[model samples]
Target: MTTPARLSAPAVATPVPWPDDSVSVLRNRPVRLGTDPASLSRFGDDDWNIRPAHRDAHTTICNLNLRVFPEPLRRQFRAVLLAALDHPQPVEPGGRQRSAEYIGIGSMPVLARGLQLFAHWMHLQGVRQIADITDHDLDVYLQHITGTTTPLRQQANTLNSVRTLWLFRDVLPASCRLAAQFPWPGRTANELVGLRTSNGENKRPRIQDDTMEALLAWSLHMVEEIGPDIRDAWQEYTLLCRGEHSSQAIYVGTAGPRLRAYVDQCRRTCTPLPGIPGPDGPRINYGHVLRLIGLDGKGAFSPAQKRWLAGQGLPVAEHSTVGVITGQIQGRPWRDTPLAIGELSGLWRRLAGALFTVVCYLSGMRPGEVLSLRRGCCDTDEATGQLVMHGHRGKGYDRAPDTPDAAEPTRPWVVVGVVHEAIALLESLHDQPHLFPAQLRVGMFRPSATHARTCSSVNRDIADFAAWVNQTFRRADGSAPIPDDPAGNLNASRFRRTLARFIVRRPRGLIAAALQYGHVDTKVTLNYAGAPDTEWLQDVAVEKLELVLEQISDDAQRLAAGEHVSGPSADEYRRRVVGSADFPGRTVISPRSAERLLGSTDPQVHHGEGMTCVWRPETAACRAARLAQGLPEPAGPDERECRSTCTNLAFTDRDITRRKQDLHDLKATASDPLAPRPLRDRAAAQAERIASLVHRHEQHRNEGAPA
Candidate 1:
């Protein structure tokens, strides 16, 4: 059970010159290093600010701090990381060059973090230099990371970080390079760590229907009702602060009379002096009073004046109670108490969060894309009157010389009117170029150093907003406005998935219908998948194919239970379902295989309003209409053109039950004496045909039953 001694690395004939000082691997050039001179020194500094000079305002600056690594291994680790940045590794063994680009600056921090973890492990194993590490040591390290509680994806990343040592061995200085090839060669990090590769499925959990409904409802209430008041209060507070900081000469000239009139008016109207919460009791808010009177300094009010104001018999309260509360909840005032000056900032944050929810959920924009939106990004199309959001795609870009920034090409998202309202509110909330800035305000309009709110920050905002809604508002039955989602906290990414699910489930729903006929031309494709700019189309296609397979499986189960199916295509339905009964539910299927399974002839079941369509193009009644419209032959029945006597119709027991209900409704209408004569005759004819269908279904069911 003895551990083997580490072996020395092989010597190199021509050693690469390791620089004692050089520009950081992150920066392409040190053009605007700002006040930090250490940014230019590669080996001298531990903290490297990896923020690119041309970075988008929405993207947060990244830092790679080597301070966490042990001092002895720092140089060696730095060499490996710099080599990774300087060189391009093959996409695969002997594969074509990957976009002929170096690793992106954004990915450097994550890579550095993984390397730092490996350095610590190496230190623990008494292997100081990468060259001293042996294959056996790497094998043990792999096992160590695998055994940890870290997720499989992270473990794979850590392993890939170690592989970099060997990947760039030729470029590294002889002493810093791994002599032996990385262990587990020919196997990917995913395979080694047992991380399953994605099968184009969107595993992001959709927010439950009730939860989404409640969340959207409360968000709409905040935007439509409470938002204006919050905005007005913020504007007033900002102006008061601005006026307080005005020049002394101007304030002195206007202060004397204004102060006298303000005190006199407060006393006359019996209005309370604005104050903040105090330990002893409510005390006069001197700052607020000074700002209100247009005074410049804290000592603007004298002792005699303060005493005179205190003895005026005016009430003191945390906030001005004189303003009208316009927002309501459950037919009562939304707030029984006035909004405190201190609470204004929290209200502003909540308001922004609500806006974010509305825009993100309604537009199906990624969190980053939403954050990248600028003040004037949204506009109404003049031709169609459709709201279109013009923003850059934050993903799916090749890290090339021409486009080095985070944003991709400008893309348009067809949004609803409410999305435009949210964007307008955001534009008014902050003066920053980004619609969702990191800082809303700090007494005055000032953009944050980071400029934009990160996705992680927006996530917190949304979660806090939900909690705030539940705490502040209640339903008629006394329940939280937004129920807790079992999928955990609702995030930006989940919104897209939830939206896709809803679009698929209810294509005729308000949002879906609007998107369908909007300028975006998002019909079955986008409704079943995702927006044009997103990768959701493929994910949705996979989901749809899986759904079809699931339906076939369900049909098999029903048939196994001896359920009767009748119609022209009933035998066809049984044959297809029985043939595909062995189809696996969650197993990985290639795109080609999925396409074939979803082909017109395979598992030919299409559920319609009152029947199951086992489509055969020649027998389909909807085929002629599609051809007349110059459209391609349909893969399934067009439910809009479905005919009662269509030969491809297959009626299950469920459809029969629906038909029975339809027949009852028709009979009632046909026998109505108050109905017009022609309408009654039409209803009577339809009822007779429906009755015949129902009778035939019952006869078929009885004949199929075991005797």
Candidate 2:
């Protein structure tokens, strides 16, 4: 069998040309600092598109890189730096002015700020190479980039390391080639703008009690001057405050960077966080900025983190409290009176302006979640008419782990009866649809399915609102302590803590009633679905029905209970109703494994549980077996035989045992292709894939390469 000679190959079909230097540089496609080929390939061609809204996968990627970075920095670098690198380009640098979707000024600011910071780093490294660079040029350039004034430290607080590193990567890639006659000749290290930890007072934006007081006083006067209603003007003003207006604030950076600065300033009083040093540079250490996550040395308060500490009795957090009690209300703390905020221009315009404070104190809903409420999400239950808070996420979103997703991701959230009253009161007055609604006009119609709200925004709205409320309302009793303005001011997050305190300190007789605090306690635990309340009985019943098919074993108990017990369809139970009438619901009971096997083998097993066993006298298998075994077979013509007396073969314990074991073996085999053995071949395949990835990563590492 000689095969015809294969056609001669034409001189190795012209070898493909390698990428040219210019094209290579252009197509460099900067890799995420720790991107691995295996991961890249796993994503196939969508390497840059795998932007998970949450940080888990990215955290995993960064955690893998933790070996390179220190524990303190691993998370921040990954969260900020790696994220910036992950997305190489912006969809739009500033924002789409004509976007009908109204993508908010808030939504784009952080990105702008992040990009600017990254650019700053690159600019620092390339400053020497750029033509005619001087301090004046640098100041103008930096203000242009960061949106701060001549003294970078004086204007406002900035995200230090994260901003710097991001600026470093992003700015250089685009502008390095466009330096026009000037060349960025410095080494890679010099090109990166580094941060030094400054203990200086100006570097940190101080949101002191006095500042808050002044702002409140300023707000009140502005509101009074507006006279009655400035609904149209107020709406625009709020939009401007959110940096949504075409008219931008006078700041060092662009309109976006200015908003970012606002966020930074606001966060100082909302979600106070410890400052991390810039990548490869000294950290801007402001002892004044308090940290929510405490410091190691004496656990000194990070002046930055003081906002959350407002109600926490922290000395540093007292500043905000003083302003809350004095400036906004001018009413004594002991009086159960609310000073009108109507006079204050923008004060009444904010959704969280006042009502949220009372709600947080009484009901215990998280300020952020409460603020984020929409009109229709709150409903009075049809059965009990209890106020139910519904959303993907809002307040009271704590568990023990500090997740970036906390209170940010919208998920199913419930507000208890306490929140109900306040919500009702607010609804009766205001008609905004979005809860914790933003002043930015462009972002309210819909939500981004891709990302969650930022922690800073969530915190800021809450803190500012809390301050207004505390100042607006006064306690009747002189014993009630006034909020300290310098340190403590109302913040959205303080609601959770205040809630916990309330539950613990509830009046002696009202302990049980405290469960009404959103019903998260025993009502909505993992062990149960929904609340124990009767309203959820139907849902629970259906869930239990599924579990019975998966986990239950008692057949007589199941049958006598009168459930259909053996059927292919769940809809059968829907036809004839039986469970608890108090709880009208659906039940799902499917054919048992043994019944399925028996039915398949001998089609006569068509009976639901609790039904009388059918005797197929025409061709009884037991009678036939008895006849075959030398016992007298029933003479059906004359009609009587003792063969029917054998109860052992008719639904006996031994038979059931044998049948159950058979079903177990059958199910076990079906569950695993490699049956009779515990571990399946599929597990081995998964192990091999993971091992391959590890090996590939190791190969790169052995050669001193980046991940």
lDDT of 1 by residue, 1-707 (tens): 45434333344577787856565654443222122444344655777655533234456656678888898999888777777766765343434346445666666777887898989998887886788877778888988999999999889888877765666777789778777654566677898889988755456788998999888988888877788778767766676666633322233455556667778767777877988777888889877787776663545777877887788778898654223468776677777776677888778888888899999889777777788677798877687676688876556424221222333446677787888888887777767667887686643222353356778877888888899988987777998879999988888778876775565445532222223323223532343123444354444444456566656777789999987888888887888888888755444455444545555424657665567787778988887777888976655567766777788888888887888888888889889999999998998998898888778878878787421
Error of 1 at 630 (Å): 4.3
Tens digits of per-residue lDDT, candidate 2, 488-573, equal: 55454544433433342232211222222224344343111233222222222222233233222233344346333211112222
Worst 10 residues of 1 by lDDT: 510-519
| Reference-based TM-score, model 1 | 0.75
Q: Output candidate 1 Cα RMSD.
A: 6.3
Candidate maximizing lDDT: 1
Instruction: Provide the clash count, candidate 1.
Output: 0
In model 1, pairs of residues that clash are none
- Candidate 2: stretches off by over 4 Å: 1-352, 361-363, 382-385, 394-418, 435-487, 509-519, 524-707
Superposition TM-score, candidate 2 onto the true structure? 0.28
> TM-scores of all models?
0.75, 0.28
